[model samples]
Target: MTQKNKMKKYGSLFMATALLTGALAGCNTDEDTSSSGGSGNSASGDVIKIGANLELSGGVASYGSSIGDGAKLAIEEINAAGGIDGKQLELITVDNKSENSEATTAAIRLAEKEQVVAMLAPATSGNALATVEIANKYKVPIVTGSGTAPNVTVNDNGSVNEFAFRTCFIDPFQGTVAANFATKDLGAKNVAIYADNASDYAKGLAASFKETVLANGGTVVAEEAYVAKDVDFKSTLTNIKGKNPDFVFIPGYYEEVGLIVKQARDLGIDVPLMGADGWDSPTLIDLAGAKALNNTYITNHYSSEDPDASIQKFVEAFKGKYKEAPNAFHALGYDSIYFIVDAIKRVDGDITGEAIQKQLAATKDLSLITGTFTVDEFHNPVKSATVLEFVDGKQQFNSKVNP
Candidate 1:
């Protein structure tokens, strides 16, 4: 049973921990979140309900909006091709407002009030982690398109959250790839790290990246920090510039990173800058002018410039629909909808959360717009990552790193 597409765990609930990262071996199947529906089977008559708790209106709005756009496109195509078992898929999206508390509230609404069979987690790791317990409690499979934090699937105590899954690789993989790119691809002997102090996302990437950088005999000449929502990076850039490092890695969201890049360039700090997927956003180019964004690179899920026929097809279709080229987040979002439907197709019995969760756990070698991947024991997707270079504020497909 294949054709339509190809592509791409949990521990306890750690309220505050490292963001963007792993898993436990145990699986739990407890049911309690739904009172009217059994095993969170909101899908009954002619529609399958899937909830999307996304950051649609705040700081990280771009990520959620792009994901929503991609998911909508997939739903349209799947419905046109005859949706799962003659039932149309319905996505109930709740705007998390890019806040953790809002995300949790949205998850509660989706799981308890809305009673969706399965739900899409938030785009950011911290926000996604906030919704894990809701999924586990309700026995609803919560799939995240780009939550790369390992703890999203596994707890700090080494327990796997059975209902949680992610399509993107964890932060360690992303960091290691970026470090290898900086040292091996860019020939850097020394590197500097500037991270978001307020975000575990930035901190997690910085930790993994530093370890790999030191492993490669590269020196961290300077380390700096900034909180989220920072508009001024000149002071930090001044310090970073004085270090005179060959490469600078800023593991933060697009908002701060954009200002950092523009200010860094203004200060004549012309070294190559790098980051993880958090840098993928349209607002980044507007914040940091195209010229300032040049010589920057990011370890991303997919690039619109990739020449693969499948990828190009998705890009063209996305451009036609949204009037803009798709980014890594968009591709991941598109892949996620198909991922859930793929699992639903294999369910012979009730389309309950338990049934869908079981099918999702056994997914193997499924290909999607991002890449082909299988769900690992920890519930994270083991897939290749792409390195995209920014030239004139546009992402160019650099190379792919296979695990």
Candidate 2:
């Protein structure tokens, strides 16, 4: 062949090699990138990215932090055990600043930017409700550790959102349980309820409690409302005291409940103080003192004193890791991670958000450390709750109330 022809052939071969290399690089760049935080696998296939939106700072900072820690512990344990499907779990957690809409927006950003497969929200009902719209829009599955309001899973039109689910029982069920315990077990014929009207959790619980109390032949002598951040309850307490009810039910968080209990007792309101699951916090006793907490009863997810094997194992593992016993929120937070992981394992392929949602909807009889959890049609846990009493500044398990 001529020298010019040989040069032309070599030039063509070089151009072909360059084109092939460029195409391969483009393919590699197009591959999904994984993240290193949150609950699910990352986008790059190297790790799973799970998004966590919590009230990590603000008035509910303590509760949010504890729940985030619990979720992190679970993720660490899962990673240490070889992770899900041989991929490292990454958490992309964002602090919601106790802003409901902001938290929801953060979750949406994580789903879009981080490309997370699933999300776990160890947050409040208000925040969870805000995020549910985004989850439904994007088909992202969200498992809430708290967020017990019935409306969390249902839209304003009363349609169930398949993407939204919770590990905790609904507030209505918890409220009914609390009311039954007060009227039948505590022998309280007349009850007064003080609810945080600003909180869906508090309002729902109070409504259900009032309905249950009246249905069971007991009366709600006084029903007062308060905002969550309000510290002064004397005015409300004074009004509640005028009713002279045998029991006072405060359906709110530990912070407000603690203050209300202390002020109520100081004002000579000696009636037994009853509350929902929100009262199961160490801060309740620390802030309210044992004197104020004495004779207080509250409904909870699980008790540290329970001898159940699942509960014992969880307590041991949690204490060994965090040097503290797990509360109801922590337990549920940990379980929420496992629930998502379990659903992910059951699913096949690229781990899209839609697949996770379907798997979550199909979840049945999931036996976690909390209890045997079965997601009802409304995506709420159909399980039993432990009734607890505050005895000498400690939560003592009194009995189990089944729904």
Candidate 3:
């Protein structure tokens, strides 16, 4: 769906319907490459080509590697099921190393060099945003399993980036959910926000969480900033400790978040700690330790502990295949493949970027492991967010927050 065509289909809503970019899930780059078989658009042959621009290595590698593994699993399942409408799907992967520039380069390579009709975008917001123009220029729809920032789909001018789509909810949504869980569920009358100043993802979540805190008749006792790679947080946690807040919200990815959680516990500032999905990583436990992570919480896409039949089934399959439990990024990665294939199957005739783009935009109630959602005009999935509590160094499903 080109911007012009989208305007005709949805009208001026898409114009003011746009959003500005102020988000980053943050990607780190890795130097590696992989391919299944054959390249180029499936429209040219019987095998559909899919491009994966992922953060297979580098910082936040857990996010990229998990997503890649999930996408690979989905591709395997589809191919084993006799493929998409009898045409096999080929995943051509390029490691973005979790960097924004690398993400853009990967997109270009996949779209122009590989000639894939659609591409899977980098998992983080900043990296995903870097590829928007490329996706638009090439008219190839790029679906992200975990790009949860407004800017990924909408441009700064509030214009919709028609070719970009995400399976995860935006950062603001998860942030709001966190605030609600803290204030209402945990009975926190005062919440302190410790945001990663270097991350647009953290910044966006911080702003929304503050707004919700005030709206809920709660107080923002303290607010502090930290960069992405800072190892020490005792100074900041000490300041927060003085404030005597009932809860602490740290909006950051796992690497830093793990350190903060551990240091906070060491400082004896043991009020409940909460964050967005950025905290979803096994490394978090290794960093924070099981005892330190006891009261930590996060808003995530899916819980490995969910009792839903479909979710449990997926959990078992993922475990059986990977020999480890699948994280949210993995589930998102897996779901993204189905999302793209679902649209491809719905294309009227030959599968092309434009056709797949339109179908993706029109997707309604598409069921997947993360959440069932209808793609909104913003090119985001309208779905539920799960709040998980870290108990004994593992994420346990706590509750679900609906939009």
Candidate 4:
């Protein structure tokens, strides 16, 4: 053979071998099966693994732990009843260390490593934002149980991230409702704001409340901020006292809110305290005492006393298990899991994140323990919020507001 011809033949043969090797490497094999035990098919004998990222330790551990428990309960129930698409539901959970970015990263790593089909997350807004980018990168559907910030799904590009979803109502509506109740219902003209500066939930709710109050011709006489871990609020209370406002607005979780209310009353500031859903906890009454919690108004998801069948069933089941009535956080956590399960049932298959997201977007009129929820275009829940007043150490449902 001529030299050029031999060279061309050898090159062609080498190219053909390389192509064959690449094709063989791309073929699916038993070793290539996912650790989730599935061959990427629903008919295959595989356990569907769902992941949970929450704050099992740290400052907000109490709330996060409860959320994790609620999710586990839902998974248990589903598994007992023969899980979605005749597959067993497996739950994987990790702690995000109560809003720490490093902890969130670690939890995301664990979920990704486990190859979870979907993930439920950190019970607060800050941690939710911290982990969302990672979930988006991996294309895992994450449904947060307690993150209420308006930006949870709405991005700067005016497009919703396909991987992100939430089960709670946004902060804007809760803040607006609180402000409206303060102005129209409570007839309070001058209000003072005490916000937790460290929490995105607190800050966002406070800002929304301020805007709504101003729009309703209610004047904000004073504004004070504090960190989440700070227990002493005497300084802020002293400042708010001088303003002589008709009421005080505290946008923070029950832990800090209870302390703030107790200390405010101790400091001889007797104005009624108003807050958002963060105040919905049994511990709040015990921490703040009946005297401090008296006349305090807050917005919440569902009341245990609600006559609705769904709410009643959840309350009974929760009380039977935990020996205490479930709080708004617990209800939201429970509902979030069931909501995701319903989506899974709707899109029956090898549960992919994209499939769950599409199903969630189409969710409408889902009757849940919290309330009837419909996922809006922005992925926010359109539902009703119940207004509760702590009177005589009990939460009394005053009214329900629809958004």
Q: Give candidate 3 misplaced runs (Cα > 4 Å).
A: 1-42
Give residue 257's lDDT in candidate 2 (0 to 100).
89
Q: Estimate each model's TM-score.
A: 0.90, 0.88, 0.89, 0.86
Total backbone clashes of candidate 1, pairs 3 or more residues apart or in separate chains: 20
* Candidate 2 lDDT by residue in tens digits, 112-181: 7777888886478888888887677566788888888888888768889878989888899889999999
Sorting all predicted structures by lDDT, with the top scorer first, yields: 1, 3, 2, 4
Give the Å error, residue 364, model 3. Answer: 0.5
Clashing pairs in 4: none
In model 3, the Cα lDDT at residue 96 comes to 95
2 or 4, greater by lDDT: 2
Q: Any runs in candidate 4 off by more than 4 Å, and if so which? A: 1-44
**How would you encode candidate 1's per-residue C-alpha lDDT over 201-307 as one tens digit per residue?**
88999999999999999999999999888788898889888889999999999998888999999999999999999999989999999999999999999888888
**Cα deviation of 247 in candidate 4 (Å)?**
1.1
Give the clash count for each candidate: 20, 24, 9, 0
Clash pairs of candidate 3? Answer: 18-158, 19-158, 25-125, 27-98, 28-97, 28-98, 29-97, 29-98, 30-97
TM-score: which is higher, 1 or 4?
A: 1
Indicate the residue-level lDDT of 51 in model 1. Answer: 91
Question: Which candidate number maximizes lDDT?
Answer: 1
Question: What is the C-alpha lDDT profile of model 4 across 80-175, one tens digit per residue?
Answer: 998876788888888777756855675566555677767886788778877777666666778889888867688757988666789889898899
